[model samples]
Target: MAELKEIVSTLDAELDIKSFGKDSSFSRFIPRVYEPLKFDWQTAFEKDFVELFNGLMLKGNSTVGKVFLAVFPTDKVLERFIEESNSGDLLFMHHPLLMECGDPKGKWGQGFVPIKEKYIKQMKEKNLSVYTCHIPLDCHKQLGTNIAMAKKLNAQILVDDTLNAKNEYVLYCNIEKTNTANLISVLENIFEIPYVDFEGKKLEDIQRIAIVAGCGDVVDWMKEAEENGVQAYITGEIHCHIDNDYGKQKYNQIMEYASNTSMSLIGVSHSASEYLVHKTLMKDLFEKNFNVETVLIPQEKWWL
Candidate 1:
């Protein structure tokens, strides 16, 4: 087995994508994080497992030799996973099968309810390796949704947090001299989003702005952006309560919070944010081995 660093180096070379950068969303991947994360590739998989799990890790110094297509499942989809395979073969799913967020100090507060006995037992028996990419995939520099959207719109990076090890948000510029009406028309034509709201009259010097993939319920952050002189905050969704309670608007409603401070909110289904990752990852894998095939899980739910 190749050393972990070697594997990472291989991935870097093959993907041609930078996953870490300074001033990242949360400064997500710091040196301290590197210390605790392990890169053991020694786990063995069933003979057939290699067809199932290898190639998912884009570039590695050593060959994992195990790869496969994983079907994505939703909470209600409830397709029983083939758990009893082999350990160390990582299962990279698009959705988190075991995720909940809160203080783990209490049982109720713990994130991610464990799967039922039938599923857990099956996984333990098969020794299948399971993992989910979720936001990480959506935010990946090369395969992420933000980059794809930017490409579709001919947008430029105003603040590129794509490479941040912490891997948080991506802020890209759409149009500088374009009028708001034109910008809105362009966005509506290109994306699955239905509408965009304007806070004030069309904006000038509108070339500068920030965008989040889905849901901007993080109101305080937008407020902070306003203080920083940001012309607009574009996102998929924001809390509707902000309208009646604070802004008196509908859930998808876009608001002009203050003069000289405005935002454009674009609401698309969450799946639209990361659907491109499947194809992007496939391309990376193909560079390493052309015969290898990649597939997107069928369970991802969204339109367009």
Candidate 2:
């Protein structure tokens, strides 16, 4: 247990949470829409504000035998993990527990999802601890999702000047002149995704790139890329839900912006883009720094 706390402390120190600021402003609006579901947003902010959604969600035992890492804690994944884990095992994930929050109409809201109560009960029964590191992991300079992805593409990572509302850094890279098709092929191979979505000019016109791994669908990031002279932008998801009117509008706007600006866009599955942070960066960090046994379980691709 002492070692586990030490490990968490070390991670907190290494990430420098104090410098990142405490306000969980992103999640603040969630409670207003629906009662804070699985985890209390306000309490989390009040207790450990410096770390942005980074802490032990469920306190288990004092000692941990092994650590299991994943991008999200889906019910099946969590159940399987708990079944295979011993009493003192720990589950470290990027996203938090999925919670079902509804609006006045009783329909599910945009950000909230259904909570898996059975999974939580199972974890408690098995005495398993659940730890999550969302923005902090994404903001880490050396092992962040964007940096890891940039390194895998073999692009010359220039600097981390791009900033998001959460104060996270987006990586800018200069890749040897590569066409859009070839770049898409490379990304597909790297992420093991079958297909990718591209928007904007001809495939051959892509050169300089900007990378923001998981949720790069933000318009501000796109504008920043354009302002920084980025010829191509790569991101996880592109918000193309045909059934959703708002999503369709956002998608069309992004496509139009890319076309008008002559900038290219490539998007892959969100899980695939961020999985490398667990499989490569966290694995290496834990094994090298703490000499701990770590197992990385990739989130199953839900695209079928």
Candidate 3:
């Protein structure tokens, strides 16, 4: 068993962690978070990004021997692990510690600037190394967003309409050729969520399907399913628009109408549908001989 730092170093050499992104805000800081978990298994992050991301891809890599789970308030969370584990290991995370969208050159151009700054600043101080895989991890066929969830529900895949290979997708899956109510029941049972909006007129013909994680912004992807006769749609969240004529109430009414017209929409909270992506990933990692741990971040916000 190696110390926390040693394991990080090994992963650094292997994954080229140093080259993940230098100019990005987190480039200089994230490594500090991974240092402490090398030898100490007990000191790792529990529910945050590290645990979530590691859960998804831990099985694919044969080179990684072990991993320490660490949940850090800041980057300094590395201190907890370094005291426990040994070398030849590393840390992986969900929820990007550093992601900048828009303009990388402009101020606040980095994706999620404020959150990145707060976390990365602490990481730099702790001398820890961290890595995160968001969409890519979610879209892996063997261990992807739709595949994992679909398997649990015994859902038959209709299509994997991913615009990009980076986990951007609208996955269509069918439930044992059931009615809308039965399909909804199956989804609730499979995901353990209590409710979803089912607007399909005839559930009996609902043998085909479509679903996606994250904000369902890809209208084209959703449309493709409708074009192909997908009766039900599942997604992480919903989109609402309001105008003077179409207030919040009106907007929702229109949305309901929309749902009733074409495909039924099942709005599963983004994290709820995607949680297995990490949990199952972690299971695979543990099964693959890499000592791994998980941390789940609490949902700070919720829809009213």
TM-score of 2: 0.82
Best by lDDT: 2
| 1-304 per-residue lDDT for model 1 (tens digits) | 2233343345444443243322222123222222243422223222221222222322222233233333233443233335322343334454433222111121222222333445434554554444334444455666555666666666776554442222256354644566566767776665544554334445645665556664454555566555445555555443332213333433233343433346543443344444444445534553355333333343333321
Candidate 1 Cα errors over 4 Å, as ranges: 1-72, 75-91, 98-129, 134-145, 159-170, 176-206, 227-232, 240-261, 281-291, 298-300
lDDT of 3 at 48: 29
Window of ten residues with lowest summed lDDT in model 1: 101-110
Against the hidden reference, what TM-scores do the models get? Answer: 0.50, 0.82, 0.56
Between 2 and 3, whose TM-score is larger? 2
lDDT of 3 by residue, 65-106 (tens): 445432222233334433432333344554444222111112
Predictions ranked by lDDT, top down?
A: 2, 3, 1
- Candidate 2 structure quality by residue, lDDT tens digits, 68-115: 888766666686788888886778777664422112122422543433
Task: Please give the lDDT score for candidate 3.
Answer: 0.47
Judged by TM-score, which candidate is best? 2
Q: Ten residues in a row with the worst lDDT in model 3?
A: 100-109
Candidate 2 RMSD to the real structure = 5.2
Show model 3 residue runs off by greater than 4 Å.
1-91, 97-113, 116-119, 122-129, 158-168, 197-202, 240-260, 295-304
